[model samples]
Target: MNTIDEQLWDYIDGNLDAAQASIIKEKIDTDAEVKNQYEELLRFNLTFDKIELEEPSMSFTRNVMESVAIVPAPVAMKTQVDKKIIYSIGGFFIISLLALFGYVLYNSNLTMPGFDQKINFNFNLDKYITPTTVYSFLFADLVIGLIFLDRFLRDKIVQSKKI
Candidate 1:
């Protein structure tokens, strides 16, 4: 009556005492909903009882483990480039940067006029440009060009070596 509870299932499963089971049986007989729920639970229990556990053949597990062990583990390609070679290349760039910064600080000739020098403002870009600056620009461009060419040639040589 007061809505079917777990005690009803316990009764259906024969987990309850005779007295409790009798009480549930009386309620199930009187209540349509309780009767339907009990019957459904009974069918489910019967179906579950009919089901059997299946065991795989003994070799099934052994075969699976063997297959997994047979799978090759990935490996990293050992590089020909030495650690010292990489460090030297990085050190060279660092030294070059430091030298450039040192040169700029040494020759900057920055005078803080502070509005006293009466700086003449000129829009003429040609007067500000110098041969040394142009050559420096060309030198930097050439260095970059050489680095790219080296990379391209190195890649081609490596690829050819592979073949």
Candidate 2:
């Protein structure tokens, strides 16, 4: 027979084995202090369990559905021109440009303010495209490409192994 206060409390709360429960019941009936303690705990448990849960209004779900119904579904836009139509428009533009060029050649002002003075605009290509500049640019491109390739290969290997 268990006389420990915790064991007695457990048995009273319906958490004890059948044999243990009998022992606690015998103790509670015989001991006044144990009986009073058990009653107090039971009362607290019942009081908390009886507290009511709050409910929302009956129209809450209906109001939410009404709001959702008011909103319009998103619509997708349709294309007006296909590939053939785009090609036809491009052909028309080219033909118009050719006609304009022919008209300009046939009639244009041959005299200008600075017609006698020739403007010689020469850009030194050597300054920009040196051997060192080309090599450094190529090296930087190679490094960036290598980094992406390494990541792609690693991911492919992992996926292949998983499969």
Candidate 3:
């Protein structure tokens, strides 16, 4: 066991057993360092206890609730992936990527800028495959496909209602 300072302090605070308390009492009487450390900790704890906490404004909770009501609640993110949704999105992404890749391959082989033998890097294929062009195609296709799907679903719902 280490120094009895913690047990001594706990004993002072009435938080120790009678046996533990008696052991600390004997140490405190003989150990000058333990006695001084225990007194310092107790003084620090007493200082914090003496400081008062101010209560919040009377309408604080109400005002906070009112402000929160004015601000829209954050949309909860979907925790589980729907396989159909994943497949749809993945399919669209792959299709768009392949289309862009085909376009780049065609353009690069035909009339791409900075592709002249005098100006082009001899090794980097990224010279032909631009990220900006690929991303633009991907985003455009994704958005367009989503819009078309939404419209098709809406039309089906309307038709079913009529039927």
Candidate 4:
């Protein structure tokens, strides 16, 4: 808006001090353009005053509040997990691994040859260790590593969120 329109608005809204109001009033009375603009602004102000603002229905706020209330609150990942269940699963895996190791050790030949005699270290591993077995072991290790990494990352994220 131009300075004249601003001044006229201030004049119409009675926002200007006596000196500014008097100056704008004189301009509006003397200048034809200022007078026309002032009349238009005055008509707009009157029309705005006469307008009745639309209001929401009485149930609008209640309906919105009810909908909001119906939604379940978010749960934290840590809280959703039970410590006892985690401990039991870890314990079961550890026990099974130890039992398997014990069985392997018990069945293996561990007799040591005399120190004076020549010890033959040659043993055929082709029967037990194939290419497929090596690949499967490596893949299992990779998967286990990835699972550990995922857990570590999730813990870090949860810790950061707390902060």
Clashes within 3 Å, all models in order: 0, 0, 0, 0
Q: What is the lDDT of candidate 1?
A: 0.87
Candidate with maximal lDDT: 4
Give the C-alpha lDDT of model 3. Answer: 0.85
TM-scores vs. true structure, each candidate: 0.34, 0.32, 0.42, 0.42
Flag regions of model 3 displaced more than 4 Å: 1-5, 78-163
Clashing pairs in 4: none
Model 4: per-residue Cα lDDT at residue 128 = 86
| Candidate 4: segments with Cα more than 4 A from true spot | 70-163
Residue 55 local lDDT, model 1: 90
Report the C-alpha lDDT of model 3 over 83-157, residue by residue, as the tens digit.
Answer: 999999999999999999999888875656875566554776787679988999999999999999999999999
Select the stronger candidate by lDDT from 1 and 4.
4
Candidates arranged by lDDT, highest first:
4, 1, 2, 3
Error of 4 at 159 (Å): 15
**lDDT string, candidate 2, 81-142, tens digits:** 68898899999999999999999978997667856877778989999999999999999999
- Residue 4, candidate 2: Cα error in Å is 4.8
* Candidate 1, position 85, lDDT: 90
lDDT of 4 by residue, 1-163 (tens): 9888888899999999999999998998899998999999999999999999999999999999999999988876664688899999999999999999999999998877775777788888898899999999999999999999999999999999989
Tens-digit lDDT track for model 1 on 1-163? 4446687768876898888888998999999988888888889888999999899997999999999999988878886978899999999999999999999999998777675766778678887678988999999999999999999999999999979
Candidate 1 lDDT trough over 10 residues, lowest sum: 1-10
